[model samples]
Target: MTHSRRSLLAAGATGTLALTAGCLGFALGNEPLEFDSDRVAPADETVAETGYEERTVEERTMERTEEIGGVERDFEASIWLSNYSKSVDYMGQTREGSAFAAVSVPGMEVAGQSVNPLDEMSNEELLTEFLGRADSDRGDIENIQQGESFTLEILGESRDVDTFVGESELEGEPIDVEIKLTSFDHEDDLLVLFGVLSKRFAAESANVELLMESAEHPIDT
Candidate 1:
């Protein structure tokens, strides 16, 4: 995975909010979460049919601060993430495609917000934070056109997700792309999936959806 794209995904992972009305009363903890990359990521055989190959799966630690009762508290959060990508030569040019999944710490409260910012955050706020990356000049994605919200099955459950269409520059060449963004609870953590594929191939390919569907939570042994 490219450094710029990795950084973009890391930023998006940190900005994700998983709080909901049912979770507002949960206690806050300062201890960092733990994750096993193998258990959280999809199997290689599963990714094979998706067209994109699994590039990397690892644990990431991020630092965040929140103010509570006028006191500043720093928190270290853990994310188990995976990157899938593929490259195809088309019309004498190389087109790049990618997708990412990050498992979020359940009940982690974001900074600058009250006790339970996650629960208080609206759909607009959450989507805004997730999609904000598309507007970054430091990132390759640009000219984002957000589409409607709908429900889809992920990790065996139906969840609301948003779709986006955009353009990105790869090695000085422009490529049209389609994106799907969704977050849902699985086991004890919240999983977020951000998928992007070449527009030309998206219609004819179900790779992105296949990648998501094939993921497993690493059943306990």
Candidate 2:
């Protein structure tokens, strides 16, 4: 069953790209949700608010192990969340570029396959494309008429790949999310994880434009 799940995940990566195009034209729903930066404080604040009873950052190391396709994979993840944004660092024992960071909502899970941002493209180009697509589809339920799964193809300077975008509602706010997984040629038993975390920038549909303008590197270190 584990092997099968891994296989399904792999296939899902490819299929996500293909389905994005069709999903881009549908209306999913239009229930607005409130997004208060204060609702979910950052890791540090959460710890403080909890009276420091929880584990400290120095003591906490997020890790998960699983066997996929007859191979054992171990993942260690660290997260830093702030009022403005969130970042995650994922490391795998066998992957070449074992480390990568994503800017998103705090406590977001790393799902799907892994992708290397240092591949043949630049971060600015990649982020630009991501924000552009999200902007084009902002507040438009027509893009999500076919359930919550959809994929879109994004063109880059030297290469192009399909990206899967998923949507959900939280606290009356619309949540737009994406995941990209790619296999590295150098590693036979490793996969890359690429993810996007986003919410409506504001009450109006214009917030998409702000997010595009404000998007930056999730992790500085």
Candidate 3:
């Protein structure tokens, strides 16, 4: 964990003494909380005010097709966009029930214009550049170790994906991390996707492969 995150955890831990950690998770990315006050509200009231509900939902298989860059494309998956963690670090989960977390801290990097200078590189070069940058960019993650590098497809675009192993301290408890990252390349532009999940969930799901294959053929598969 980074020093900044530790500080947030410390503050949140202290703040959670009066309230619950769920409240802190609710405040995750919404607003800067003012904890100087001594007011303590009931747990149910606190939950009601935040309006962040934790839900376990089953996924539905679906497909979407579109034309981009004068080429036809298809996207099939068992999950739709679940922005349940919009105000937090995660994106959503796959139909196989794995969590998708942000690779770069929000606002630290934007998906606009594919700032990826490797857009013109060979597949080998792109994978090499991406793994190195990913190691550096994810500073908020702890003990991250790169696993493998390969090409994959998303939304009919072939791109390089790298597997990673790391650690995360959720609610002050350490959890093993496994993540896959890739970019959807289209017309010299890119769409980056990052998925982070616990070791237990990783062992139980084929979501990583399914997501990469959603568009039909994953690169180098």
Candidate 4:
């Protein structure tokens, strides 16, 4: 999200208050939360495709907040770059949330590397093959107790996800918020992008969608 200088000031004001509340012990963290299946459904169909067979680009900006360790942190604005090609498509998603931001490219591959390693495997196969190793390397998802924090989990080289949580105080009231980003590769027909940008900051989430829509490189039909 492109933010005027004025908007940054407003976001800072909101963040300052949240930080204060956190310091006062008004917020706390929760255990590793399970993914809410009802809140997020897998994307089963293509949303939009370019007619031309050449590379294309799109851009968007948004501002939002998330709950981390129970405290709310504000994101002023963010940018992203999505590029697509014939052999493979890459969507680079980024956001400046809280104390830090990250950039991720989910559909990347090397000459001998696999695209969708589990393409021929069932969900159970995929989980047993990929996640079993990951869980061994990274401890089981545990709850975080601090207020306003971030966590990044590398599910695999081809798939990874991150989440940020914070608490927001607006108009003398407290509100919980969370933002998450999850991306992974699929079969040749498509790629997968999953993430959440929520809170009173509407622009933060919009920026993410804007970047996806304004991908610079597109697949060649």
Which candidate achieves the best TM-score against the true structure?
A: 1
Model 1 clash number: 0
> How does model 3 fare in lDDT?
0.37
Runs in model 2 lying further than 4 Å from the true structure: 1-62, 68-73, 85-204, 218-221
lDDT of 3 by residue, 1-221 (tens): 11111112222333322223443422333323211101111122322333322232222333344332232333232221221111233335222224432111111111121112334554334334433333122224577777887776555556678777877655445767677766443322233445555675544224444433443211211
User: Best candidate, lDDT-wise?
Assistant: 1
Candidate 2 residue lDDT tens string, 6-49: 11223233333222222222112121111111111123443333
Residue 6 of model 4: what lDDT?
Answer: 22
Candidate 2: TM-score? 0.23
Q: Evaluate model 4: give its TM-score.
A: 0.22
Window of ten residues with lowest summed lDDT in model 1: 1-10
lDDT of each: 0.52, 0.27, 0.37, 0.28
Reference-based lDDT, residue 99, model 4: 15
Error of 1 at 31 (Å): 9.5
Q: What is the TM-score of each candidate against the true structure?
A: 0.64, 0.23, 0.36, 0.22
Sorting all predicted structures by TM-score, with the top scorer first, yields 1, 3, 2, 4
Regions more than 4 Å wrong, model 3: 1-98, 101-140, 203-205, 215-221
Candidate 1 clashes between residue pairs 3 or more apart in a chain or in different chains: none
